[model samples]
Target chain A: MLMNDKVPLIREKALWMRRTAFTMVHRAQLGHPGGDFSAMDILATLYFGVLNFDAKRPDWPDRDRFVMSKGHATGALYSALCAAGYFPEDWLQTYMQPKSLLNGHPNRNYLPGVETNTGPLGHGFPVATGIAIAGQLTGATYRTFVLTGDGEQQEGSNWEAAMVAGHRKLSHLTLIIDRNRLQQGAGTEETSGLDPLDDKYRAFGFDVVEVDGHDHAALLAVLGAAPASKPRCVIANTTKGKGVSFMENVASWHHGVPNAAQYDQAMKELV
Target chain B: MATVTPTAAGLQDCRNAWVATLEQLAEADPRIVAVVNDSVGSSKLNSFQKKFADRLINVGIAEQVMVGVGAGLANGGRIPFVSAASCFITGRALEQVKADLAYANFNVKLVGQSSGVAYGELGATHHSIEDFAWLRPLTNLTVIVPADAWETAEAVKWAAQHDGPVYLRLSRMPVPDLDIPNRTFRPGKAEVVREGSDIAIIACGTTVHLAADAAEVLQAEGIHARVLNFSTINPLDEAALHRAAATGAIVTVEEASIRGGLGGAVAEFTSANQPVPVERVGFPGFLPTGSTDWLFQEYGLSPEGIAAAAHRALKRKA
Candidate 1:
């Protein structure tokens, strides 16, 4: 009954996601493990504790939709979907294989629960806005959510989408920026500089909600809230590679695969 | 010889037919919606904004979001016709057109208005000569270039009911309706506008009627030419191409880049499958400052120019 009760379940899901995602990356030797770990808690909290979805009916019209704008974090996305029961657990074994449905990016046609295909940054927000607009037009109760990386905000398309969501007053839309600070080569502050991110969303007419992205209870409180008068933007402050101490805050892990001992160390540290 | 621009009076701008048909379809299907990048007047959807105000989404000169939003709208069980100027929609929002609409395989209609050199004297940046080449490679997206007002209406209806991603490349130029009676709308099929065996002229969009005119000129010279209106660029009616190739010579024409429009597709299909003498007539590249008629005349898009190209193909056949 307590909101805090959901935290433990979310934490368990997050741990499994981190471990499983790291394993998938370890086996494949090609994954954005840092991003996967950073975004795992937010994805876990949404799938396990906050969002409303039915694994059996991924195309259910009224179901809430989540678009992963930072699509390279397929380690996080695929693991969460599998745990959410959208597909079998063994599906993760074939991740990025010869003809796997689990591609490097989220493809809606190949996999269920993937709202759209996105390998390119700055795509999901606009698509999610369209989905929200559709719901608003039909007077449907479904809400739409999109997750983007902090550095991904440098994409002009996200700003373009932000302008629309703000102007249309898309009440049923929520945008979560995974504020991991670090990008591929450097921190976001040193890269494109999104320090005024909260203010930026506010200027775009969003109801800004800043939270600790890894804090399950706080994430639940904001993400689980009902639709607002304006489109909501949750700036979830998170550390890149949160679980593994070695990978944490390291930009090289943006697309780094783990070695044998490193994998073992990460697995132990995740729990 | 100077040719009449499709935008000349007493003819029809295909955008009117497109918007009219879209409004008619939207009336019956509540799922039908229009998403524009602040192109209400240019896309001829001002009345659509008036009648179905809520359904018309004006994204304000943002082509990328306009297209991505169409995919999202389609995901929400609504059929969206994302309309914008041909140059911006195809050029600016190209990645979205490929990833969101085509690669994702969303059921969205992307209507491109004022295609070709419709924006005459506005410089090469506004001309969508390379759109066919750019979009043709995206095999998942069906590309349709209607010849006139009637075909524009039919293509709009067809795109709405087709249940997949379709790129309706339209022109603001005024064009007379094709003389073909009982011409039904087929997605990937070519319509035989005129019959001839000496040489075949395959054209699409604003050039179909001109090809028909060239047929008459060839007829006066006792050289019968077949004119094929190739409305669909991707999924080329190969059966038709084979029949066109059977004519021994082929002259392909369009208001697009010679490298990758209807001409390019026909040449690609013919050279590999059936070798024949092929003459491709279209823009060379970007152009100098000129009106549509002057540009058409300069770039060999007129009836006389097309007829000359047909003769060149025929001579090569000889």
Candidate 2:
């Protein structure tokens, strides 16, 4: 129950999540491994130790909601969901197949844990804000969480939702920006400098917190705190491919699958 | 083609009917809520907002957020009616509509006000002439363009209980109410206003009244043209369309572009099922500076223009 005592369990869950995600992507032959790796630890912490959810009753009205805004990292979220007993772990082997429920992105219609259908960038944040607003309206005691890619911050709609969230002072909402530095092609700084990300969020009435994305203890500590009266934003600083030795901080690995030799080496490194 | 004079002036803005019906539904069901993009005045939701201020969510000019929030509210077991200008709501937030409401199948009603050149003097930027074409292609979205105030009220009531995504296109333009005798609004059913065998005159939205007037002109010319009011553009009443095609000629009119609207829909349906001589009456392209009436007349959406198109279709039939 205590945050400190849960670190080792969460770390083990995070490793399993990374391994499952990598294996799914490798078998499916199409995925964003770098972003998935960067976001896995956060997903593990939330599903395992931070959030209140019932996998058996995914539609429980009082259950907390999570939206994976960086939808390309579906592998990581799927891994976490499987670990949390949302679905059969055997289903992960059929990901991205012809008729699999595990689509390239999250689809709420097909999967129960997916709160909303989100693949297009900058969409999940506003939807999460709306969910938070609903919680406020009905006096429901449930929190809403959303994760977005660093490159996805360039969309103007995110700011639009941010303005509404700030104006409404939706304290039940939490937004996590996967600040892994590398986008698909180049670094985010080289493309669209987001150096003052914290100031921008703060100006928009968010309680901004920066944490090491790979550190389960730090993530649990920051993400567990409640907002005073405004929405919360967690800037998770991370390496693109955190666990793999060759792929860490590499831009090409954003969506690239590893070869057989490289895959074996990466699996060894993960262990 | 002889021109017939326009009808007398007993008209009501459809937005009033929409707001009245919405308030009634919200009163009965606590789950119904209204979401707007700073469009309370334009959408005529002031009275409803006053009645249930807590349920009225004003997202302040952000169309994307407005729609996204509607989906979220629906996820929370609240039925949200999202109201905004047609041009901005459908054009700016089309992806959100496609993904959040349609694909996700959320119980959200999208009310597009001032549709189909209703904001006539505001120029092409304000024209929602492309809404039908844009929304019809997306799956799982029921597209309804109510012809008058009674139909608008009925459509809003129906959308409230439908339990799926709906796009209700309401107009600011005032037009005489066509007598829809058994006026229940169904998703894809066409109302036959008149019966004949010479030809069929199909119309919808702001142009249905014009089609009725055109039928009178054709009748005077000894051509008894049937008149059909097609309120639902998608999931089109193919049975009614095929029956109309049996008359050997059809004239379709609308307040939107000649392509991909009521005219295009009819043409596509008829060509695939029953090929008949078809002539489409609508705006060929963007309009110049003019009132809605002037634009309607200039772009062959008037009763006289519709009559002329009927003659052209008859000639092609011959």
Best prediction by DockQ? 1
CA lDDT, candidate 1, residue A93: 90
Candidate 1, residue A57: how far the Cα is off, in Å: 0.6
Grade the docking of candidate 2.
high
* Per-residue accuracy of model 2 over B211-262 as CA lDDT, tens digit each: 9999999899999999998999977899999889999999998888888888
Query: For each model in turn, which proportion of the native inter-chain contacts is also found?
Result: 0.91, 0.70
TM-score between candidate 1 and the true structure: 0.98
Task: Name the docking class for model 1.
Answer: high
Q: Compared with the true structure, what per-residue lDDT tens digits does model 1 show for residues B42-114?
A: 8888999999999999999899999999999999999999998899999999999999999999999999888
Give candidate 1's error at residue A259 in angstroms.
Answer: 1.5
Instruction: Point to the candidate with the largest lDDT.
Output: 1
A57-168 per-residue lDDT for model 2 (tens digits): 9989999988898988998989998999999989999899999999999888888799989889989998898899899999898999999999999888899999999999
Model 2, residue B304: C-alpha shift (Å):
1.0
Error of 1 at B233 (Å): 0.4
Q: Worst lDDT window (10 residues) for model 1 chain B? A: B1-10
